[model samples]
Target: MNHRGVEFTVAKTAIPGIWQWQFRIGEETKTGKTETKIDLLAIRRVQLRIDRELKAIGQRTGPEPESGGMVAGENA
Candidate 1:
């Protein structure tokens, strides 16, 4: 599964109703499990975690732009 240039995988686990997801970036790998079995939600969660990690290391791509052409934290 490719999302925003990042490749990831969301697979169902042996346990019913449980899903596992994994994604790798460079030499870093992230993994998690969700009970919802919704791939999109799991992917979003993973993306958020990655973003948080990147922000902690000061490697984020800055705030995302909001609607009306305004970026987050920007004063109109």
Candidate 2:
């Protein structure tokens, strides 16, 4: 699924414990052929980037992380 400039691909496999969510960044190589890869780290980074983009669009919620669960830095 693609929204605005963000392209998100969510996939599920038959393997019960295996799952993959890939982020396709449109980049052309030297040959001018558009290629795609699974950018796991970029997907994770999107949380921060998306928040900024959202706020820029007048959707302000302070600088809170886009998660509903306890983050690693929060006190348990």
lDDT of each: 0.74, 0.45
**Model 2 reaches what TM-score against the true structure?**
0.29
Number of the top candidate by TM-score?
Answer: 1
- Give lDDT: candidate 1, residue 40: 72
What candidate 2 gets wrong by more than 4 Å, as runs, is: 28-76
All models, RMSD in angstroms? 7.6, 14.4
Error of 2 at 17 (Å): 3.5
Q: Where is the poorest 10-residue window by lDDT in model 1?
A: 56-65
Backbone collision tally, model 1: 0
Residue by residue across 1-76, what tens digits does model 2's lDDT show? 5545656554444544333444433451111111134445434444445445545655543565677788788898
lDDT of 1 by residue, 2-73 (tens): 765668788878987778888877788888887776767776777776667666645456665577676679
